[model samples]
Target: MRKTLLTAVRDARSGLALRLIAILSIAILPLGLISSYQTSKVLEKNGALSEIALLDRTRQAAAEERALIQSAFGAVEAISAAASIFDSADIDCDAVLSRLITMEPKYIFAGFVDTRGIMTCASNKERANLSETPFFQDQFANPGGLVSVRPMDATTGGIALNVSVPVVVNDDLIGRFWISIPLTLANDLLGESSDTANLLIFDSEGEILATENFGDDRRTILPQDRSLQEIVRGQQRTFRTHNRRGDLRDFAVVSIVDDTVYVLGSWEPRNTGALTGPSERISLYFPVLMWIVGMAVAYIGTNRLVIRHIKRLRQWMRLYSVGQIDFSQARLQSAPEELEAVADAFRAMAQRLSEQERRREEDIEEKTTLLREVHHRVKNNLQLISSIMNILIRNTDSEEAKHLLRRVQDRVMALSAIHRYVYMSPKLSMVRADQLLEDIIRQLVVVGSADEPENKVSMSTRFDPVELSPDQSVPLMLLATEAAINAVKYCAAANGGKPWITLTLQDLGEDHVKLSVENSRSGLAEEQDSDTDHTGTGLGSRLIESFVSQLDGTLEINALPDRFELHVSFVLVKDEGDDAL
Candidate 1:
């Protein structure tokens, strides 16, 4: 089975389908992989860059927070130092506190303490316990020095950053000056944004000082080693982070003093992981869709414009290969430039093939029909000539007359030989003149001598490959027959015969034909020469002239003692309407 299959494939032309499949594979696979990879890379880069941009904006917000906190701390330090020079003799605490309240620093509370750490005056009097303040206690322990602390606020219940400086009299530590600044300014600095998450401020001990939520106290400070925290601790610069929700968040923390750490955190959501869902879906299916569309179009285009026309052309070619050749009209409509040119070539080929076959068939048929008619007419003419000679022979009493009748019979019989050859041949518009003449001469020798044949006479033909149509061939053949008979019968080598006949055909360089018949024979009788130009010339001579003129050809007659020669020149005019026929 395997061997049979292999043989069938070899006979059939196996590689066409495999080659198309390979072409499709080669064309499609690399593009598919490359397109998928490129699409993936594009999506990846877009998502990553968006995330980076979002983180950058959040970091900017965080940096703004650090700036706001630092500015608020500077205000608190200015107020605390200003309180140090306040009255000690008049002790007009109310007047001094009212003057300090006019400073108008945002979200700051200022107050003062007496020599014994007793609260004297307060700007936020409802919330102040100056003697118990963390800033006041720290400054009293380190006398004549400044102190700052992030402490729980008594009024708003949020943390406040407190700054303190010693009140000195004559360079002696007398009392303390203290001020409080709320941490809610961190959230205020980062303005309203929907995609921005809650901002929180945390103290150095990781206690929530301020937040976007009012009543919430949950501390959300990042670990100390987090990117945001490290950046704030190391350089007081901005940094960004990703939370558990995959939100890009940023924060800035700055230490206003040894005890005060200000923090600002801002978050914006990053969904790079979510973008893959749509991108992967498109990547998985886009190439398959392209291939399906491409092949479908290829098949349809190839079928309508290429395959069907080629099949028709192939069928026409097969018919042309055989001998039928009857195509009168063969045309195809192949569009698209290349296919149209191919169709034009096929049409031309079909026309040529049909013309060739038609000419071939016509040649065969014309030869067959013309040869049969010529042979039939020649046989009838010979029979009539023979019959007429027989009648003349009976009427005449002279030996010469009887001899002429006998010679006429020999010539008639020779003409009959040519007819027999034409009848036997498959197509015989013309005969090979040399072959016909040789056979006729041999027959003449056999009949002329009953006991012995003339063996010393030689017959040689110098004819070119001349094909004579029936009109030219018939009379010329008969003339050669008659001449050869006269040569053998009347030539002058009495006992030892050395006669010779040479027949030649030349092309004449134009559309003319020349037929030469030569024989080494002595002069013809005087009667034959007179008959050549007159109406009483023998039927053979007259018939030769008549046939030659009928074929639109000219004839020449030459006579000699050593040679009886005739050279015939004629144009081989083709029949009119032959091409159409």
Candidate 2:
């Protein structure tokens, strides 16, 4: 019972049941905490919503202010056009001013000022003066040039827009036309659905011109700092500054008429509320409750279902490891989910292993067949070379012909030597080229010098040990055989004595091999360039060139008074019969 319980605990630790419990706890805990936080801050969230809504209302109010300014400027442009006609007309200044004053109620008054800075015509008779007014003084300040617009009061002592244009003819100053329009129509632009918003317009002189409400605190805002007043004078469209109410407010201005910039500003405090603690508490509880229920379900499943099935499956797989295949009684049966599929997978795996064993046997048989065929072909090729050498021997009787046939026979024997080594060993294709060369030289001593010791040539070898594939080994063996025959025949005849032939193989760096043959012979230069018939002109030189060309090697023949040497060097590729291939 104790072992069973321990196994159950181990299964539970590795199983998904405990993992699901952990995931539920992690996923639901943070959500519960966030919901609880929101519940506690419900009132704060509402206040935040209100503040954001007010900021949007402020932006809308600024847009309306710009539209109102655009409309008022249109009216001013129209009035300026009408006043231009008076310069050529035969009319009194007083009559012209009267007609302009009655043209629109939005215009509080209209008049004209002369070159002497005197108001020549009056729409408001009481304040009508030829001089002494700021408007009259500002009008003639530019004299005969473009007149400046001023922000001032209407005749009713309310904020107003003031405009003036110089009456010029042929670049000569005549007088200035002036008009003042009431700013009451501009208040229509300031009205907003949000309660705490207000719009105001200030001029360059730090004076309020048109404002929705001129409370003492807001009116004094321009006097406290030059920033707001500068915004009015310049053409900047959007600005933000602190109002006298100590609230950070955004302001935007638009030109209603020339020189009169209308500004709209609204305030918002940063700490407007969003959510209450109580509302967040309830939101947090739902996810926490779900986590508890999920954990309970997982704990029940760990003990009742997952542990039981997994322990049985583990024992069955352990038995399957030792080649026990009776799974029908020990087979896993569990909930019809991933566990049942895993049991079926185990059965299928066992059957696949059995099928692979049979395939392995068949592969061994096929490889055996291929190895035998390779050996057979190698034997046939060696026999063919032997037959060709014999045929050439029968067709010729000259001492040179006999020597050539003997060299061909030796090369055939060299190939046969490699074939015997491969056939004797277990390996199918490769024979070490060094071992093959040593054996061929040993055999050549017996056959080429069996009759006479006076005609004997001492053979010696020097080479770095290297392996060659059969394809390379065949051509190389033929070249060596030819070089050996040349050393024996030529050097023996000329020296009037037994001579020595040395075979040396050198490895030239990573991808090349060199074969060197040198013989001790006097008058060696005369022999190589001799006009002799079969010995110099026949198959030996051609065979040497063919082997060198086939192996992509360079052959250098050096003849001295006493020594004759031949060197062949070529690229070495990996042997074709390498085991990896």
Candidate 3:
């Protein structure tokens, strides 16, 4: 599997489609990069806008709370100014406070606490010790207008906003005048907002005074790693963080009453525009998608418009190279003009080559037939000459002259045998050296043995297959004939042994061959000495030497008492046609 994948990758790297894809990718790279960068900028801008919008919503939600606090401060100041009137005799402080509460329905309790923490001029009949309470003590120490949240107000008996003001008449400081506003009334005043956001109003101490739209799972909506005090300390107008439940949320903090109260609004991050939410993710991947799409288009276009036709042309050329002469232009018909022209050029070249090959083959056949006829006529003419010599030899009365004529006739027959084999063989240029040598040796032995029928000469021939061009075969055969004839002429039984002649053709490997002709020596010492003299004529020796020179062979002769051996070794000559192939 790994090898298959590697092969596929290697093929892809070499293919035209990959090259085209690379070019297209380079061309589109800048545009893709620019698109991605612009998308990122858009996302950043949308994020800033989202933060601003959240802060605006938080400030808007705290508007009612701001108004209620302002009204409480106004009421406390009005009651403090009226403290001098309460100092006169015959004034009903409780009645005055009750009527005041009746006029302002948002105020649940309105009263004045003296320096000793004695409740007087109260709106309700319930009495509460003022001095021991934290709000009263704080007011006593500070002696200024204050707004405080009470979890369980001593006067109202519920969560309420304690707005207090210092009570003083002229230069004399008396006590504190305070109003209790129920949290339920404050929530009613604030009302509900349109957006699905959780609103929280907390004081400077991080104590949550009022909440709107908060669920029972309040911890889930709040920041997991931070407290309200940390958020107030940071004083960040807007921020983004994951809530306790691991849900991402955007938060906005706005001051409702300058360092005293702050409102925090949290909601799920909103999609400001196109580059937000799911669209933001798409924007981030847009560049990669662009590159992939471009490469795919390029690959498809290149495969269809170019590579397919080129491969078809390649296949056609391969077929033509392997001798498939049939040609067709239809396959490239759908190709572009450039590719079609290339196919046309190749087709024309193939046609010319095919025509030339056909003509050359015809010429070779005609020449081969003419050459074979020439060799056949030459063989017949040489036979006729030998027959004429036979008639001359029979007519002659001198024994020496007849012997010479017969020798000449024997040489003529050897030449005739070479031409006969040439025309009879399938290949005109090359002949099998072993077969030609065997035939020549056998014929020579037969002629020599016939001269003395009583001398029983056993001739054995061994030929190994070897091929040579006609030029080499002719000389090789002539040399073998001369050597075999000499061997046969002197062959005799040694010491009551039967006379024998052995002719051998051996392939010595590496384009070399050896021919051997050996015959048993005559038993008589005088006859063996005469055998070394080559039939008392130097003509046979000269002829053998000339034939050996023509064959470019090295000749060796060994005359032992038992036998005479002649061996020739030569490099086989290869045909020109075989070399070309």
Candidate 4:
């Protein structure tokens, strides 16, 4: 993955699309920055307004809760002012309290507690003493109107709000007139707007009084770092924090009753009603969308306007380099002006090169035809000379003169054969040496056999394909002719065998070749001495040496008891035009 990423980055640096994207991005950078700044400011302003709105909603919910509590307080105060309920024992306090409870369904229990913390009058028959309860003791010590949350009331046997007012007869506190209001009443009041917010009511002592729209997993949504008391300290204020579930929420704290009760409203920050859904999305994504659109346009435009044409030109150049000069100008006609000019230049160069190549081929053909004709004439002239020598040999009577004439005739025929092979070859500059040597050796064998027809000398020849220039082919042909003539002249059968001559041409690797001519020796001692005496003239040896020198070759001669062998090895020099062909 790392290597692939590095390679991608390197390619991107050199790619036209990426460069265009970078250029477009830089051109729009200031506009993007400005858009981002404006978005931040808009969001910040909306956020401030959202906080204020939350605080206001919290205050409204708190007011509703306070009104419910004050109503309970007012009922208790009104009942305490009824002197007949506290002062006149005959007024049937239980009946009046029970009647008050019946008239107000919010109150579950309404009664009066005397100074000794005894339930002297009661709405229900079941009664108990509250003197030992902390709320009763605090109320008795303070002796004023008070409101508190009761988790469980002894009279009602359920969660309720205890609203109390001191019962005074003639400025002497007789007992406390208290009413038990069900906590459900506060919940019902706050639940009306619970869909928009989660509400929780807390007393001065931080005791929860009621909750609205809270689920059983309330702990997850509630503040984790602070208690209700700490939060309520910031009265009429709003703040942000992450709930126990790690969700960021906005919270507002507002007083329901002065130093007595408070209500907290919490909701997710994303739920802020400052902007519509589409508006918010547009604000957040506008800059990024703009950048993407700009980059896309740049990439497409560059690929079409420049890259595609350049690629076409590059392909054409590649084909032209390999001699595929044929082209269509239709594609180039649509390219930009500068690229079209380049295409025109390349087309002109290819045409000129093609014309030059055609002319060169024509000149080579003309020269080769002329050269072949010259070789043909030379071969015919040499053959004519050999024919004339034959006529002289037939007409002369001197045996020595005929012998010399035949020798000269043999050399002339060898030269004629070399010219014949050169002109017959496909290439004027190179001749197949193996074929020329084969022809020359056959002619020499025929000539040598004719001198002594009774002997009927046996001959064997082997030739491997070898090519050479005329300069080397001529000397090589002459050398092989001389060797074959000597071999046939002195050949003798051994052990009752017929005289035989072997001619072999081999291609040694690395541009070198070897030619060998070997002939058997006679078993008779006198014939061997006679052969040694004839070789003393040194004419054939001298001719072989001179030919070898011309061919830039090495000569090897083996004169054994049974056979005589001559071998010539030389490098095959190739013509310069061979490579061009």
> Predictions ranked by lDDT, top down?
4, 3, 2, 1
Per-model TM values vs. the true structure: 0.37, 0.39, 0.53, 0.50
> Per-residue lDDT for 1-581 in model 3, tens only?
99999999999898888878888888888998899899889888877787677778777776777788878888889888888888778888888888889998888888888888878668886576777777677778765667777644657876677888888877777888888888766655445653567777776667776675333664466777788899888956677788888888777788876677777787767765421567777777889987888788887788889989988988998898888976854457479999988988888888888899999889888888898999999999999999999999889999889867877887788788888888988888778777777777777777777777888799888899887787887777777776777677778888789999998888889988888988897546455344434334466677777878888888887778788888888887777773443
Full candidate order by TM-score, most accurate first: 3, 4, 2, 1
- Candidate 3 regions with alpha-carbon error over 4 angstroms: 1-15, 28-293, 326-331, 396-403, 523-537, 575-581
Q: Give a tens-digit lDDT track for model 2, residues 1-581.
A: 99999998997687777787777778777866776667546544664564455445555666755554455445445545555565565855566566656876556766656677555566664334456666666656644223223444434364455655666656677676666655555545455523565666554444565556544555643322346566655654444556655556554444443554445454443333322234434444655666777789877877566767776777877887886765654455555578788877877776787577568758765775676667667777887888887788778778688765776688777767767656554555455667777777777766667535567677788767776666677788778877776666665534676577788877778868898878777773465544212236666777888888888888887777777878889887665544543
Largest TM-score belongs to which candidate?
Answer: 3
Q: Where does candidate 2 stray beyond 4 Å?
A: 1-402, 492-498, 507-511, 528-537, 574-581
| Pairs that clash in candidate 4 | none
**Residue 460, model 4: Cα distance from true site in angstroms:** 3.1
Candidate 2 local Cα displacement, residue 51, angstroms: 42
Q: Considering summed lDDT, which 10 consecutive residues are worst modelled in model 4?
A: 525-534
Q: Tell me model 4's lDDT, rounded to 2 decimals.
A: 0.78
Steric overlap count per candidate: 2, 26, 0, 0
Model 1 whole-model lDDT (C-alpha atoms): 0.59
Per-residue lDDT for 283-388 in model 4, tens only? Answer: 7678999999888888888878788887788888888788786664536636789888887787787788878888988988887888789989999999999999
